[model samples]
Target: MKRQIITFATLIAVVMGVGFSGCTKLTDFEDTNVNPYASTIPVTQNLLTGALRWLPATVNSDVGAIYAQHIGEVQYTDASRFLGINFAYDDFYRGPLLNLQKIIDFNSNPETAPTVVGGGSNANQLAVARILKAYFFFHITNRWGDVPYSEALQQSDNLTPKFDRQQDIYTDLFKELKEAVDQFDSGAPVEGDIFLNGNPDRWKKFANSLRLIMALRLSKADPATGKVEFMDAKSDGVIMTDAESFRYQHLAETANQNAWYARYLTRFDFAISEPFLDYLKSVNDPRIPALADKPTDGNANYVGMKFGLANTTGIGNNSISYIGSGLREQDSPELIISAAHVLFTLAEGEARGWNAAGTPDQVAAAQYYVEGIRESMKQFGTYDATSFAAYIAQPEVAYTPADAIRKISYQRWIALYLNGYEAWMEWRRTGFPILDPGPSPLSIDGEIPRRQAYTTLERDLNLGNYNAVLQSQGPDEVNTRIWIDKP
Candidate 1:
C-alpha cells in the first residue's frame, strides 16, 4: 500500500504560512495556462489518501491534553499554564481541506468526473469528500468559533473571505453530513478510505455517528434542534459495535507511525496529570494500569505530575508516570470516534428526555451509561466481567436519575481519555468534573480558556475579516465564549 507520509515538521511549516494561501489564483497568463511538466488532473485516490493523513488525532503531548488535564508537562510547563493562546488553523485548510475540495470539484465536474472513476464512482467519491469536509469543519468551528466557511477555498476569487457565525456553520455542517450520506450510490466504494476500508456502509455509519455527536453539542444552545437531529441520526443508524469504531491505524514505518511513538523516541516531557490519576484512583477505575505506566523510581507507584505548575525544575523525569506503553507503540491505532463515545451520547440524550423508545428515560439512561463504561473499558483493553460489575456497583459509579447528567459526563470524560480536544469541549459545554487551573495560572482572567485566539497570520494578512469577526464574536480572547457555548 502506498501511504502518504506527512511529518510533524511539514505540518508546522504549512501552519506557519499565511491562511487562505491554500487556494491558488492565476494572476498571469503564463500561470493560467497549464505547464506541460505538471499533471493538471489530480488522482482522486491519492488526494483522498493525502487528506486522510491530515486528520487530527489526540496526542498526549499536545496542549489540548493539557487543557483537558489529561496530561501535564514534566519539564517545560508553559502550555499547561496557558502561556500560548494563538493557534493556527491554516494547516487544516492547506492540507486536508484543500485535497477534499479538489476531490469534490473533480468529481462534480463532467470533464474530470469520468477520469477519476478508477478511484471510485463519481457519486461515491463526492459523498466521501463532502462527509470529510463536514467533519474537518466541525473540528475547526468548535475550536476557534466563527471561522471562514461559506466563501472559503475560493482560491484567488476571494482571498479575504468573511468569517461565518458558528451557529450557521453548524447548521450547514448537519445539512452537509445528511446530504453526503444520501449522496452515496450503490456503485464502487471510495478506494482510499484508510479509516473504514472503503466500505460505504461503514461510511454511512460514520457520518450518522458524527451527526449524532454533533447534534448533542447543541443541548444547551438549541434543545429542540438537538433532539430532532439526535433522533434522526439515531434512526439513520450509528456505530453499534466496537468493531465499527472510527480509528486510524498507524504503520510501524517512520513515515506513517504514531505521533506519540515518535515523540517518546527521544523525549519524556509529558506525564499523566495528577487530577486525572487521582480521580481514577479514587473511583477504583480498572483502566488505570492500561492508561499510565508505573513511575521509574524503583517502586510500583503510578505517580502523576501536578497540572500547570509554574516550575517543574524539581520534578525528576523518572518520578512521574508516562503514558501507557500500549498507547505509544509505533503501530498503535488512534481513535477518531468510538462506540463508547456514541453510547455515552445516547446516555446523555436519554437523560435529557430525547429517548426514542425502549425503557423509561432514567432506566434507559442507566443502561446506556453502564454499557458506555463497558465499551470504554473494552476499548482500553481493561474489560473483565467481574471487575466491571464490581466497579459499577460502587455508589459513586451507580447512576442516579437526579445526578444522571453529571455522572454521564464524568464517565464520558474518562471514556474520551486521550481525545483531549473533544473532552475539553465537553467540559466547556457541560462543566462536569470541574477542572481547576494550576496555582500559577496565566490564562485570560485566570480562568480556563473557552476558545483559542486567532493566529497572528489572520491579524496580519486577513485583518479586515479578522477585525469583523472580533466585533461580532466578542474580543479575540481566550475567555470569550463561542455562540453555542451558552452561559
Candidate 2:
C-alpha cells in the first residue's frame, strides 16, 4: 500500500510535471515497473553533459569581457560600449536563464533523464542529477538574488508558484545537497554518470567541496548555519588534494568541446585585457606567455586588444588602437572547483576566525595554495600546461597568512583567468587584488555591475513569480544584494 501510495504521488507529479510531457509514466521510457533498465540512465546523463557546455558558452568572451572589465563602473550601456551581448541584459533572458530553465525542468522531473547508455531506473544516476540540480540552482540564486523556487519548474501547473526569497532558497539548497550527498555511496555503476565517470567517491568529493563553498558563501548572512554545513562537509571527503577534484574539460569540436576553443578558435574575437595583463606583469607571472599575447605596443610583451572593437571603425575609441596579442590557440577547460580553490576557501575561513574542516586554516591553506598553483599549472598541462609558480617565488611571492587571505584570493583570481566568469565571482566573494578603475560607457553603477538585472522575458513567462521576486528584491536593479552581500 505504501509503495502504491508513492507511485500514486509520482503520477500526480508527472501529470502536472510542467514541461515534462515525456515523463508522465516511468514505463514510458523504461520498464522500471518490473525489471529496471540500466541503459536508460543516460537520459539524465545527457542533461549533465549538456550543462557542461554552459560554463564556456556564456562566460566573458572578448566582446563580453570588455563589459565584464567595467561591470564595476555604472554608466554601462549596450549602444555605447559594444557590450549588448553580454551586458545589455538579453543574454540571460535568451541564454543561461532559458537553457537553465530547461535543465531544471528536466532534472526536477523524470521525463528528462540523460540519454546515457544505461537505463533510467538507476538510483545512482538520480543522485547525480539531484546534486547537479542543487549546483545549478545555487548558480541561479547567486546571480539573480531571489527567484521562483517551490513552484519553479512546474510549468503550466506551477504558473503561480510563489517566488522564494533568496534566503529561503539558500536554506533549501544546502539541505538538498546534504540529502543528496547522503544518498550517494560506492554504489553499482549508475547510467550516464560521466562527470566522475560513475565514480561515487569522486562525486562525494564534489559534494563536500561544494558544501564548503556554500558554507563560506553564507558565513555572513547566517554564520551559525554556515558553520554547521562547513563541519559536515569537512567530515565528508572534501577535495583536500589532487586525488578528488572536478573540472569542466573542453574540446575543439562544436558538439562537446571546451568553451575556450570556441572563443579562441571559432570566433577569433577576443584579446587579453590591459587590467588582466597589468596584473600579471606586476607579478611577472610565468603563465602569461602561455595564456596571452606578446607585443612591444602592449602592456607586456603580450597584450591583446579589446574584442568586438575594430581599429578601422574610424572612431577615436575604436579598438583598432592595437592592444597587442590575444589569449592563445585556445583557452583551457573550465574548472568547476579545484583542490587549490578549496584550500584557499579554507584559508579565508580561518583568516576570518571560522572553523576549518580539519587542518589549521593557515597551515592547510598555505600548503594548498602553493600546491594549488602547481596543480593549476598541471590543469593546463604542457601545451595544456597552466599555473606558473617559478615567478611566485620572487619578492612579492611566498606570501603567508600575515599577508592574509587576499593573497589566496589574488591567486584564485589569477587561476581563473580566461575563465573570467568565475574570476569575477571570486573577486566578489573575497574582494581582493582590486581592479583598477577603467572607463566603460556601459557600466550601470558608477562602477561595474554587482549583479545582473532580472530579464524582461521573466516578466512574461513567469510574471507572477517574477513580480514576487522583484517585490522582495526591488526593481530587479543590478545593485540589489542577494543573501551574501554583507557589505
Per-candidate local distance difference test: 0.86, 0.56
Q: Residue 5: error of model 1 in Å?
A: 20
Give one clash count per candidate, in the order shown: 0, 53
lDDT of 2 by residue, 266-295 (tens): 333344555666666788666665565344
Report the lDDT tens digits of candidate 1 across residue range 1-487.
0012244765665684455355574243345435679766668999899989876443332778888888998888889899888998887777788889989999999998888898999999998999999998898888899999988876556767889999999999999999999999989988888877888888899999999999999988898898899999999999866777788899999988988888789999888899999999989999999999999888687898898888888789988899899988999998888999999999999988886662349888888899999989999999999999999999999999989889999999898887888889899999987899889989978988899998787888788988999999999999999987878
TM for candidate 2 is 0.74
- Look at candidate 1 and give me any clashing residue pairs: none
Model 1 regions lying over 4 Å from their true place: 1-40, 57-61, 356-360
Candidate 2 residue spans exceeding 4 A from truth? 1-121, 185-187, 242-244, 265-267, 295-300, 304-332, 356-361, 382-390
Best by TM-score: 1
lDDT, residue 7, candidate 2: 36
